[model samples]
Target: MVERKLFAGHAVRRLRRTLALTQAAMAEALDVSPSYLNLIERNQRPLTATLMLRLAETYDFDPRNLGASEPGGGSDAIRRRLADPMFADLEVDRAQVEEWLAGAPGGAEAFARAYDRMGQGGAASDGAPDPASAVRREIERWRNHFADLDAAAEALADELRQGSGDLYSAMAERLRVRHQMSVRILPVEVMPDLLKRIDLHARQVQLSESLEPASRSFALAERLAQEAQGEIEALVRGAGLDRLGERLYRRHLTGYFAAALMMPYARFLRACEATGHDVELLMRRFGATWEQVAHRLTTLQRVGARGLPFFMLRTDRAGQVSKRYAGASGSPLADAPGLCPLWGAFDAFERQGDVAVQLAELEDGSRWLTLARVVQPQGARAGGVRARFAVVLGLSASDAATLASARGLDLRGVAVPIGLGCRACTRPDCPQRSAAPGGRARLVNDRETGLSPFGFAGD
Candidate 1:
């Protein structure tokens, strides 16, 4: 009997496209020649075991599918959707499904989304959580980085820049002069549940008195963003998307403008470089919150004056990632699902004010230095829900020497091994492993149990 070689050209192509890498770039990362990758993509050559392991190690790929031992297409999702009782009588063949997935991947994905939406509640899904999930997935698809908006924000910052002056006051002044708007800081009792509200008819903006100066200034900048809505909307229009897409874009734009106004690009970039990208110093200097400083740090991509490329991750106490930002130098941490419980982000909750520094080694053998600190949301004076989350700022291990925060620390010694998510991670000895991974078969032992709850096939 002869064994057949499996070809997964589509999956390889899809992974490369998801990473936004060119053939040459993807090939280099996979440690293969571009021509060889081309052959593999064309199904002219079978994806080898060595190449499969490389893909799993370097990227968020399932090792099981890399071998093509089972079905390796969108057929599974489509079949699952078709299996629903709503389509109980309908007949679909495996070949036809494969054909659709192979030829029309986007349509297949749309079908999945539509199927999901239908099951969740359809047109009535309005005001429901489905759109929020869709919006989040969309943001994740773009790695939470918007180039056009980032450029416009930098331009605004440059225009509003002053020599050793307060940027927030400058923004307020601009709003008053250009838009005929009055800014008022009202008492928290009067404002109550609202942090800021714009009375467009009255041409006045009211903010809560309970907020700190930074929060008040950010609220003012957001009002200014509304004043420039025409300009901002024009920029958003060119980006091109559906109604919901425009909403997400506008929300991001509002926040971007606020951050830019709070920490004008030129001055902030200079200060970041001078302070060796110190978060505390930046926060104190700009009168911004730790979350705001961390967010602004990810936007320091101004052509010749670019700061060190950084990625920001915000997670709640439960370890669910809520917000993420990837810089222009290319998002090495883009779509990174590794939420290792041991990450300092979780530890920050217990550590209180202290920022925890950690060195993380990924499955690919690449390393990053992560700084984690807890952030408490303001505007809680109204008895509103106050949510506290941890924000982690990560930079390449190579950039540690350039940072003052990591000064005098032995970068080589305290390194921790981490994986993506439990379902996707294959770390066998991880005592923190919560679930079995996809590629490996779970081994059940009635006789004895180990430190880790689950064991894989090899173990």
Candidate 2:
């Protein structure tokens, strides 16, 4: 048997920089010569098991993280980026991509960022930033968790004495007593175009009667999040967003605060574990909607008592993604331009109100346990038409044992092959291929057609 050498120089260098330690200092701490440390940092020497143990003991670092790739600098991301038509003539190979990532992860990350910006239509001609992309990146950077907001919300939840009575009533009482505000459930006819409205003169937070109990409670929580304006505003100011992006980020933070208040991190995590992450059970327990529960599940990133790191995506029938959070799962599907049609998110529309579970295998052979369910927005109705979306929550299939949703599944069976999207997917035999792969040349024949509509020459 051959042993695989761990050449994680980039990770070591990054760790050293993060600790603000010079190479000599780190080498001294590791009880290694400076020349040997230099060789290790240059990938000329492999990281030994003993050194890994030392690192864990000395720095309280997880050795497993050494094998982890930087965001957007992984070989898979590089390959996907190279699949773009713009790189067709480059002839870059997987080995080269891996080598680049290993040798200079920083440069690889810069390249990834440039490629992503180009994919997002590049920078504005007038030098203006794309606010939506900026906000998404900001959320991704935080891994969808705001510790300060979570702490504040948990404290506020305790103050409200949540378990003693209904949360909505408690929130309303708090508002009335502290803020001198009143809560009113107005008929839809009275506020035809609004779900929630705050009247300063009336000193009332008016909610449309169409809102469900959960939504009404959320509205009250949102209003209460304003009391934590200083915290949310501090995060917003540090986000480096322009006026529009700042506004959007502020709204996102407000929503985060509201969800945290509704679920209260410590208690919600306990419920999630006790129920095996049953979304419906959580909805009933927390007085939240299905979508809200799914969204909250993505934000369960508290340090010591963390739940499963789930990536979430909300898409419509047309396959348009309305919301996405990668969380800590690091699944490329969260960042894909288009989702695979074969994924259960699309199947969810066929079985509305039922959870559709899929053990989806991406082109890179990474398996994810996905739970998809169709949800109709609370007040999204017009002329008798209801707007619907599929909320898909996923985590690495290896964690299926901890996931109740994946119970009774055949983990060893042939998994459903999915991909990032048709454009970047390299699966030559996928019947559902909508577009020819980006860098492949079409193999046109007059006499025959393959299983796929678009056949291309193999690499």
Candidate 3:
């Protein structure tokens, strides 16, 4: 028979040493006697139940792993803290940090890392991001945009569900009555607001603004969506999605109308399913960019139609998180903590010119299938410098099995150790990083390297 042992005494000793915290400090945090902590560290005495709970609850350490077990998820987040310069001020030992990570996990670190990343702040700058103001702007925009769309969709959904002769016909009838002009799409070179009403001679249409290919496409889509609002509403209402699921469903419903007016959903869905979610095929079918194809793919899950549920995020080289949208009828990530290393989505950007596909599991014990690739967009006309953005999409692992990559891998009952690669991340030891944003030392620098990148409170 095999013999069992106590928790990882080595890990306890190591974590304390790495944090550069003295035995007294550790004792204070754990609410235990310094002598008791010293004895536990030296393995002279086992950690008691009260001490264990204190470590887990107070300092956010895991008591189970204290006996002796490999670290599970969230170790990356914890490890990132060692990279902080604060540790350097006190001279935390590297061996100690590694040993601590090798210990057992407390709870989920995925959410914790995300919260830390976004909440971290630095010294003041003249023209930097004002998080408070930025959040207010985003909230206001969402309230206005979503509230209006929700009202419009609700009215149309009720109208069609109550008495539907045909979805598009009703919406089209309403549009013609309101605008008194038929929807006509012309090739690019012509639109100036991108839409307009011509009062010349007999009668005519208007162009709101001159559009580049992408903008022109969306313009046509918007008009199409307006024309077929009734049909789209019917499709959304019939889906029977949960509240969060319904929000995502309706958002996609509107997008479907826009895309359909251009490429048509029936045709696109058939083509996509036939091709097993091939980007090239979908892009060619819709005359869209790779990013657009990725965004559109997230729209397939509606009305329990059994489509892959996906979330999409787009960011530029400057690290501006421009767009983020969740797809499908449901997601534990419908409210993901935001970008964090434990998630492993950013690893896709390692190779500048390649598409990186990865399977990631969150701290919640749920798995996500991800596809990430970079896109370089040229500026409009003349001489605008090239711009680059990384786009990523993720979905529930089970819903993505139609793809061959996820088939053989045992997503459940298995834990994968992923690294957090940047101080910008929850992962530590990412040499590629120059410094944390806002020029502060990372929260984890050890004493030897007194100059850690940047220090953020969440760490």
RMSD of each: 11.7, 5.1, 16.1
User: Which structure is stronger by TM-score: 1 or 3?
Assistant: 1
Task: Give candidate 3 regions above 4 Å deviation.
Answer: 1-217, 228-256, 263-268, 328-354, 361-366, 376-379, 404-459
Model 1 clash tally?
1
TM-score for all models, in order of appearance:
0.68, 0.83, 0.44
Instruction: Kindly list the per-residue Cα lDDT of model 3 for residues 1-459, writing each as its tens digit.
Output: 112233345568678877899999988887778987776765557556666677788778855344223232223223333334333344344345444433323332332233333442233355443444223222211211222333344444455435544434443444456556444444435542234344444333333443346544554345545545565565445534445545555555566455444444445567767777777667765567777777666655322233455667776644456665554313433333234444444555676766667776643455777777887653233454556678877777766767544556665645443322233233334334444532234466466443334444332
Clashing pairs in 2: none
Q: How far is 244's C-alpha from truth in model 1 (Å)? A: 2.5
lDDT (CA) for every model shown? Answer: 0.69, 0.83, 0.50
Model 3's alpha-carbon lDDT is 0.50
Off by over 4 Å in 1: 1-164, 226-231, 329-334, 382-385
TM-score of model 1 (CA atoms): 0.68
lDDT (Cα, 0-100) at 309 in candidate 1:
72
TM-score, structure 3 vs. true: 0.44
